[model samples]
Target: MKDRIIDCLAYEGKVSIKCMSSTEIVEEARKIHGLSPTATAALGRLLTITSIMGYELKEKDGNLTNQIKGDGPIGILTAVADSNGNVKGYVGNNTVDIPLKENGKLDVGTAVGKKGMLYIVKDLGIGKPYVGMTPIVSGEIAEDFTNYFATSEQTPTVIALGVLVDKDGVRTAGGYKLSLMPDATEDIISTIEQQISKIEPISKMLDENKTLEEIAKLVTGDENIQVLETINPEFKCNCSREKCEKGLIAVGKTELEAMINEEEKIEIVCNFCNSKHIFTKEDLQNLVDKI
Candidate 1:
């Protein structure tokens, strides 16, 4: 199936669940970043969840950024998403390779290390952005996000993120985020908890061709669910050479002059899309004149 994010309400609207199949998005990222298997798993999981969270933004101009800085071989991973759930991300070490777990699973926790923080920044294009932070619990994206919601946002949440990678590329990737409304009773929460414990990984379910609606029902143990919205998610970068020029101009006239005098050409590469922008010395001079 195509990459899609579905928002649904279960348990008669007392429980909220967002499900997404992000295989295409993750595969594109793998090709763009030349990611190793473990790196694909780590960053892919981050990108998947970030897209779902970004879809929660109310304003068209709003966005969300998720940053994971850990003490592992994979130094850092960052993903950004627009209000429409288009996401782009880059890893600190795309070539990072480590041994898998004894169970033959990607050791994302070890690859991401548990000694840092998970930063969630929400910019609503308003007064000031809100930033929430929580300690990394397992360096597994889902567990870290679960802690973030419980402690930083004071919301009870369950998150599942998975990315299956092989020699070809990302085989499957997806996730789900479920939260309880204030009015959700103890019985409802208990039922959900039980259901979640028995469900398969999100990626596995997606790989098995389970639709988001079916996954929602499986996870929430509610046969009847209300679909709120369905959106297509994509791996898109908004970076451009014009944006690069603006960044270069921000370095001041003196810096521009210095660049013009010392360098024959300046090449700016975007971390998100790996797009390169080249500025000749004459281009620098022109920018200085504009200043």
Candidate 2:
């Protein structure tokens, strides 16, 4: 199925919820990064939520970035997303394989490490970007973001992220972000809490072919929810040779001359997409002249 992100309001528009199915996006990351099962689960969960949050950006040129730095084997995980919810990400270590929990689930918390920080940076193409950060409550991506929203953003929110990796690749991957409006009633909040406790996991629901709209209803216990918008999220990288050339220009003329003298050709690889850009001696000389 195609990746989708649906925005809705439940409880008579007192609560806002966003649901996303990100199987294809996660699978694409797996193939691009050659991630192990544990690594896939870690990065997949982050990418899922990143796409949803990216869709929330208002400006056409706005973008969001998520950074997870932990003391685990995976080191640092980074995901960048645009206003349309198209995202690209990379893991510091893609071959990390750890033992599963007794419940037979991927030990993402252990793989991601508990002692770390979650950073959220937003550039809305305006005066200054907004940066919020919080310590990792649990290296399980969802809980950490929940804490971030509560502590840093000062919003009462609930987040669920899951990724199921089979022998082939990501079998299922998805997430949801739900927030209570200021005018939300106590009774409605209680009902939604109960509903959230009873529903199946986001991954299981997506694997069962449950649509994002259905999942929104299931989580909010509001059959009469209002669908605000539907968006198609994608795993895309904006890296290009021109961007790489700009990066090389910033390295200073002296450094460029040294690189040109040492090697006949230089290569720059994008961390997010692993795309390579080669610069020959002539190319280096031209850039040096420009500087």
For model 1, residues 32-93, the per-residue Cα lDDT tens digits are 99999999999999999999999998689999999999999899899999999999999999
Candidate 1, poorest ten consecutive residues by summed lDDT: 164-173
Model 2 gets an lDDT of 0.94
RMSD of every candidate to native, in Å, equals 1.0, 0.9
Q: Give per-residue lDDT, candidate 1, residue 162.
A: 96
lDDT of 1 at 14: 95
- Taking the tens digit of each residue's C-alpha lDDT, what string does model 2 give over 177-259? 99999999999999988999999999999889888889999999999999989988899999998888899999999999999
Provide TM-scores for the models: 0.98, 0.98
